[model samples]
Target: MTMKRYPIAIALAVAGSFAGCWTGGVIQLFSCDDPCYGLDPYECDDPCATCEGECLPPPLLGYDDPILLWTGEAAEEAAVPECPPEAPGLVFDGYGGFEADHVCPECRCTEPSCELPGGLTGSASAACDGTTPTSFDAPAGWSGACTAPAAVGSGELGSLLIQAPTVSGCAPANDAGAAPPELPAPWTVRARGCSGEAGVHTCREPGKMCVAAPVPRPTGFAMCVRYLRPGAPECPAEYPELREIYREFDDTRSCTPCGCGPLEGSACTALVSAYEDEGCSALLGAETVTLAGPKCVAGPELRIESMEARWIKDEPGTCAATGGVAVGEATPKGATFFCCQSDEVIAVP
Candidate 1:
């Protein structure tokens, strides 16, 4: 009976070994190797362990203090050092330096120049004092020199004593100095219109008008007249006659004289005849005259003399008479005749 039991035991062991092999094969076929198994277990690299939260350190600290190393309330507190408080009347001097009295000098931060005080010198000292002092020798204890206690009854002497430099050979000579040599008078070149003659004449100062008046026989004559500036008082004596005509846009516009012309009515006609004798015939003729008001009635007879050697039918009259007409019918007479019709000659009829 013992022999039989031993054989059964061996068979049972064999069957158990086969069952273990089958179980191991089935597990290997269904399960896969973990991709993140041997790698650093920081963030999720394994698809299967993504939702399990098995990763040791999270990718982001998530609201944790950046400067702190530990997580979950174990981080050391980080306190910034406090800066020094600013003092009154003190400011930064822009070079990492500070000054209590921040008022900069005229040349600010630069060494002061050796300029003489204002009331002590005139413009001559400007060129001499435009540099800094290379060597300065002050009296001993000059820092406290003016701050010393005064004598009991002595009046206050001024704080500092300033002395001008002693200059030699700087005296100006009285007789040696002579008035500036007189300058030659300035003259302007002008052309004589009648004979086409050119000559130079003395010119006036600037802003003066060079008026060239018409000479008696087509010659030229020039005179300088001071130009009237704006807002100047009327000077009729200075400009007795119109020396020049200017088209200036100012109050001087009213000062210009009226031009000679054949104006309206009998009064204007008579004025034009007296003032402008040369233009009388054209002005009073029927072709030009159109007397609207009062109808210009003829006046006293006027005698005229012809300057031309020959005369035409409708030639204009000049000199002492105005508007002459021819008497006889259409025939060229050797001599010219005067036409009479009150004062004005109507035509050669």
Candidate 2:
């Protein structure tokens, strides 16, 4: 399924430099510390991807041919300091410089990206570590044999997983000569809203899955898992009918790995010969945010969550005038973009 993200962390006033920015950063590995991400030349297509998870990137920033970086650290790829929906982000002035906020609160990441009738766990992020899932869904049919050789020393570390299908409604036909029905089978990523039907799976990541609790649904809203009969197609035609086109399902694509290259040791392997600007006044220490922002910022009826900006003066207000903001002061207020609380995150001057 094609998913477009709306980076909620992007403020559009400053550039960001950090790990979560999709432009170029770390890769989300499994839930293991000291993860050694393997990059093979021709392993699987793409694995360990987090399309809709904690590292949801803000709309203000994005990735360009992003390569996943690996570390054997048991880090929280899905955890942000304070935001509810912990996602990677960028602080960009849109003039060639940036900062990594690690939180995208403004962008819309809904699958098919049409604002589903739920929370923001369904958003997207560009800065997902290997531990943080980049993309996952039920394999088309588990029809392929993946007994390929381990790519160790071969230059690429790939990822592959196998799970039993979760069927509900119909009892899989095991009769002597029973014919399997031609319907879609049950399968999906471990996301929350995904397992609405017997044949579907769901995500559990904080800001990337179902809300803390399921809300009351209107009349025809669907929510039970359907057990697909054996011998069914992957996805049937005339499905979703525009609302949630089956293609938009969280686990639409299988968790396959894409060969990148041999893994990097620690810190940085290759080094630069000389320095251009000994000191360019670049930022080093990163700013911290709340862990509950994502939870408070999602849903059709959101809130007036935050406000911060840089390079602006009065009328715009800074931390000095606002409170403990910690960003954007020595400029004109009109020269900045601020994030305001509303039904959904709204951008203000």
Q: Provide the clashing-pair count of each candidate structure.
A: 0, 101
Q: What tens digits encode model 1's per-residue C-alpha lDDT throughout 4-53?
A: 11221233322212211123223111112433333354321222221110
Model 1 Cα shift for residue 190 (angstroms): 90
Model 2 / residue 121 / CA error / Å: 90
Best by TM-score: 2
lDDT of each: 0.18, 0.19
Q: Indicate the worst ten consecutive residues by lDDT in candidate 1.
A: 65-74
- Model 2 per-residue lDDT tens digits across residues 266-335: 1111110111122312221112112112111112211111111111111211111111112221111111
Stretches > 4 Å off in candidate 2: 1-44, 47-81, 88-330, 333-349
TM-score of each: 0.10, 0.12
Q: Against the true structure, whose lDDT is highest?
A: 2
